[model samples]
Target: MGERLAGTVADAREAAPAAPAVLRVIIDAKRFPALGEAPPRHVLGPLRLTLRAHEVLVVTGPSGCGKTTLLNLVAGLDDELDGRIERPGQGRLAYVFQEPRLLPWRTVAQNLALVLPAGPDRAARIAKALAEVGLAEAATTYASRLSLGMARRVALARAFVVEPDLLLLDEPFASLDRATAQRLRLLLLDLLETRRAAALFVTHDLEEAVMLGDRLVVLTASPASVATELPIALDPAARRDEAAVAARTAELRGALRDLGSLP
Candidate 1:
């Protein structure tokens, strides 16, 4: 198992291209309209960051700290903010939101087929993605009929099927049960091992950040900005072990506590 994992990591390193920048964010400032009869409130600003190829950057901060807002800007979902975001012009992007956001009326396979381009092997691709997430048997099942965990798996499959250049995840496992979340996390790690993409995952869970991130970027309470950036030096295989995860989690917690951001 160890040798296999080492080989996988090596393959990933080789597959990853030498890109100067996959994503860049330069935010001079950001603000939002306040409640009725109030002035605009600051949200986030004066921040600059870059994501390289095949990197997983995790963002963690208190609730309402503009984490989602930052992702929106990167995804080009929101242009009402004060920021300049850059992404590779020819790159494809995929996003996994907190909610599964699947088409309830469609079957699992049909939902995945929506984003995939028409091709001779489209069906095969869909099947393979479902198998990856342990949902091959659920392909014909209606998305609305599946449990929350299954639904999330389908969502993940949809994202991976597109084979995006930049992947954005906004608390994809936020409301899942502990066991389900852990399983999905492993699935995510496995998928990332084979797929080379720059990913930005936003979550409030410190443990999740330490487990999934190449580097963790802690943000301020509100009007979020980078607080501290910590590189996770553990090997990908070691990070899966309980002891290693615990140690890394503790280290991240201490860092957050010192910044007064740990809840």
Candidate 2:
């Protein structure tokens, strides 16, 4: 790869706080149930999260550990969730799920248009977003015609067009190959720097966490709680070596090995 997208940057050097909203999540012992079972079980945050405005907070955990559930609660997607989730004001939020969730019937441009304000500026903004993801040539293409990675780029465009105050991502690159994932990782960092959106990202990859996260928060095995908050110690201009991204991948993997649920 050319260079690690995030480069070696001090975690403290992340974008300056811009959003006025202070986001707090307080869940007192959450419970849910087996997927096919009648009774529910809770495995997510019972603890609280106080995300100081204008920062990226990443949740890294194994599959089935309720990373998505915790994210949903914070996004108000699961209103059935009973918990105190607070925010500054009517701040806008954008969610990028594990799947692209693009509409098959819509063209890339139209799909992107859904997230922008309904006005004359919307179309141009959508086009710009698609270009940012290097999908300008696919503007009129239908979702069904795109590859998984392309579909994901479309999703990224959609999520970013709104210029949301809070951006929530759920394993957005989980299905892509390593090279493709790394490329998008760079794009995401560039976007984060420019958009300055407060982000809550959930991923299982330790390398990804150390690479992108300002503060890496790990959840315990089922019935999750914040188990670790590993702050990255790279420079903003951090790059990779031929061996790997700064050769920190193995060290990060080792750190996560200590987490019993790490895959």
Which candidate should be chosen as best, given lDDT against the real structure?
A: 1
Deviation of model 2 at 116, angstroms? 2.1
Against the hidden reference, what TM-scores do the models get? Answer: 0.88, 0.85
Q: Give, for candidate 2, the lowest lDDT window spanning 10 residues.
A: 1-10
> Compared with the true structure, what per-residue lDDT tens digits does model 1 show for residues 137-225?
99999988999999999999999999988899999998899999999998998888789878999988878877888888888878778
Worst 10 residues of 1 by lDDT: 81-90
What TM-score does structure 1 among the candidates reach?
0.88
How far does residue 5 in candidate 2 sit from its true spot (Å)?
Answer: 43
- Report, for every candidate in turn, its global Cα lDDT versus the true structure: 0.87, 0.79
After the best TM-score superposition of candidate 2, give how far the Cα of residue 172 lies from its true spot, in angstroms: 0.4
Kindly give the number of clashing pairs for every candidate. Answer: 1, 19
Q: Can you tell me which runs of candidate 1 are displaced by over 4 Å?
A: 1-19, 33-39
Task: Write down the lDDT that model 1 would get.
Answer: 0.87
